[model samples]
Target: MTGLRPDTGRQAGTMLIVFGVVLLVSSLVVSAALAPSVGAAGNDGTPQTLVGSQGGGPGLHESGSVYLLDGKETKWKAAETDSYFDVTMLDNGSVATGFMDSGYEDCEPYESPCTHTGFRILEPTDDGGAEIVYEYSFPVRTRSNSEVHDVELLDSGEFLVSDMEYERIFTVKNGEVTWQWNASSMYDAPADPTTTDWLHINDVDALSEDRYLVSVRNANQLVVIERGEGVVEVINKDENGDGTGDPEVLLQQHNPQWLNNGSVLVADSHNDRIVELHRNNTTDEWEVAWAVYEAEGVPFSWPRDADRLANGNTLITDSLNQRVVEVNESGMTVWSYKTPYVPYEAERLPEGETVGATTYAVNEDATVYGNGDVPVLSLLLILFQTGIQVPFWFTELHVGVTLVSLTMTIAGTVLIVRDR
Candidate 1:
């Protein structure tokens, strides 16, 4: 067999590089051509929906914002911060939300250029703008996965906050932590909790004056802690008593809603579905009472929030899909709004996330669909990197383009090196 001469190899390498560039450019064009229509699908009466985006992606918190939509039209927006999480409109017409911002002097043991994570109250202006009227935030070491994700204004004039930095849930009254519950008391603690995302206790809600619901996301469990007592109950409690919860039940859930009838609604993020769990009074077990795997003819991709409206409809924040959809009990998309970025939580006002849901029978045989299969690329882009984003239209064609481009680029470099 005759070997390729240096000049031939160099020519082959150049041709391969050109092919890789062309494929990449063509893939982007195809992705844009297949993008979903960004508007409401049907007239289900858009009821003043508020959305909280967890920044654009990973460390790109500057792309985050809290905005209001009236039937796909933005009414007012609060985008002057780095990142935003849970959002709720207070009784006095002010919005209370969790936020993160960079640039602080007091980083303490960390260093300069730290981030501050806490809550802010925004008041709407007459000019269709919003202003931060009050804020209660503190500096932290890092920005990624270290912000307060949920905040609830208690009736006691205190703010219930989920502190992910220290893996705890506490209430702050006038800037002082009135009460706190640490997850290390239950889970196996790391050497220093703040250095890594351990429990990732992202949400805490007051069920009553003494009772609270805490979402321990990394542990795949939700906990009910009383003011005086520790964990009174644990949903998805471990079977072998290892403290690592049962993932088959919840699986890295977020923003769980405690229903009035002793049930719980959860955004099962890793599972890509919205599940409602009802506690069995007889067996003392939580079972999947209702679950919806798909809407608008597509399976959910990293859904982070689901709020059951008073009108028997469920509003879902389909995170990776970059849209919020309201679905009926039959799993049909009634109304939808395309968000500018991946949203963490959403609420439809006047009767936001009240304790209401019609009982639904679980359908185990229901077909489910998720983001298109691009196994190797998916793990790298969608699963690992927090800053990178994969479009909903990223189908097998895009996957093929990406794989071929990468191979050609690497092969071209090798061929050129041999010629040199």
Candidate 2:
């Protein structure tokens, strides 16, 4: 084997090391330069907003919170759990949301330090805090995909909950199950739905006293269920006999808002966009009326909730982006607020999310935001982002820089070893 002179090898190694450090530092500077603004602090006369954060990871790994915000300022906070999911502001000024926490007893089928999942009603105090006035929870074997992801207060004084543990949508009154619609009845039944994440029924919204809109996330479909009757209608129905629905229509979607009888708004989570679908009266099929892929120049990173506000704007919880944004009909961001870690859902106060707005129809060739991301790099970044919180400004440029830095560092190590 041939080797370079001692001084030459040392010089090359040192130069490579210096270049690697410079590239790494430069990437950090670029990331800071591209950082988003803290956003409008209620200056736009936006109403108070309620946010549910799902923390950084699964149960016991990260701590989540439910908070009330006036713009970017936290007016009240409740952070006693591992994750906080769907949130609703009640008529009496209290908030109802789903939550998960660990360190509970009677964790059967699993080991000690198990998790509990359920819904709680929180009342805000005058001292920038909240107290859980009412709670109804149960122990789960595992933390992932076993929590109650949504809760709604019904007119009959019962709580409608989405139970992922049993793969069912049920209403509970005074700790008793009043009613339930199991997924196995409609879809193909698994041997054991509780053993794995079978359906991931994450959301349930009471459309009427007896009608409910349910989001079957893993199936990539939403079903409208009427009491006593099974699935009345299926949006994004699987026509090809496949177990999952059409991804082009919806893929692992969340928090779908029923906007009138003809249209609906959904956060197409896996597609990284907010989509508005209108029922084609002629064909009786749902079509994308409008969609936005990005807001405030940042590509949406796994947006989990989108609500069509009463003021014709849409409130979106951009989960991985760690911000909530309100955008006008033209896809222009009207107001934005930076949040901490990952946020699962957000709602604008006072008017909240009311049904039926003047649906806007856009041309088929309307402008849509697109981020020119490399395919493999984008996937890697997404996996990293879902597991850990990445900075909003960490873009392809940063990825490129980091890769170059790693290559240089490896080369430097090789050179030093050869010299030795």
Candidate 3:
């Protein structure tokens, strides 16, 4: 109502949907124009309290700092690679990722096929230099080639990497592919497994040594695959307490996770809800422990990716709108922030708050705030979080970004008021 007339509420509602589209178009134009002055909140001229500042140390001077992936921020020394696609930490405190061939913004140009490359970075080298444990390339057309997007390190020193274009999952041991899971095999071996087009293989996590919780975008399927010899069974959710496929489907997922209690968590991106998928009292069904979305609560425009930390906070990438939110188990957003490059995805800082994290090689560990200091599964909180950021004279940029974000705040208000 702040920007509308109730006299024509229905008419106004129709216009608002159209307004969303126009606003989206204008977003790129206006936001890009203000990019440089608003890229990352660095220094802020007045030393704003950034949660993730470096704790300080040699070769590990990147404590509380979060980098913008532009190869600039001092936090990550990009000796090579254009932009970082995905990143995960190893048990030895090292890191690895599917390094994109070029800087990722929106998406790669149609003509330039940015090949997905695989590489690893080892820290605390002898001369204060970071060493490369291994850098390998995937086959362009093979089932597990081209882009090795997400990697999950198994307890046995091997890792499972999702192959985006290939519609497959490969297991890597010391930088070599030793095993693979193709969609065709999982789906009764159709010649063209691309039917599912599960376009974005965003996340993969270990349910156990042999099973995984994989996020397949197109099929909207969150599959739990059993890797015992050759086993493929669909774990159905039972909505009724009777332990059978009693009722509703808990999720249509974009990202799914297994909780500490063995209950499954599914990020239903299309429906914009994070539904808890778990077994019911009966043997054949599952129930939705909880759901967070427009219908349930958060009313997210596009909730892309999410992860659960040991500390009970869930890091979610609110992609299209460009924000990352840390929500409590009760669905209350606790610490929230957004960044550019879609910040599309984020990995937990290597260590817990007690672990030393660096920002551009600078060391300063005065305070510890757990995942509060770290960031990003992807698109940071506000769309403006990405762009050319400067320290002073931020009056205009702040106002503009604020106005745009009012849309988000208002939607929530509308929902609340309407509910009552």
What order do you get sorting by lDDT, best first?
A: 2, 1, 3
Q: Write the per-residue lDDT of candidate 2 for residues 229-343, one digit (tens) a residue.
A: 9799989878789878888889899999998888889999988888888887778878888888878877887899999887888899998888999888878888898887689
lDDT of 3 at 321: 40
Better of 1 and 3 by TM-score: 1
Residue-level lDDT for 22 in candidate 2: 97
| Stretches of candidate 1 exceeding 4 Å from the true structure | 5-7, 18-38, 43-45, 362-377, 383-385, 395-400
Q: Candidate 1 lDDT, tens digit per residue, 320-354?
A: 77789888877778888777777889999976666
In model 2, which range of ten residues has the least summed lDDT? 368-377
lDDT of 3: 0.47
What are the RMSDs of all candidates, in order? 3.1, 2.5, 14.2
Model 3 lDDT-worst window of ten: 353-362
Against the hidden reference, what TM-scores do the models get? 0.89, 0.92, 0.55
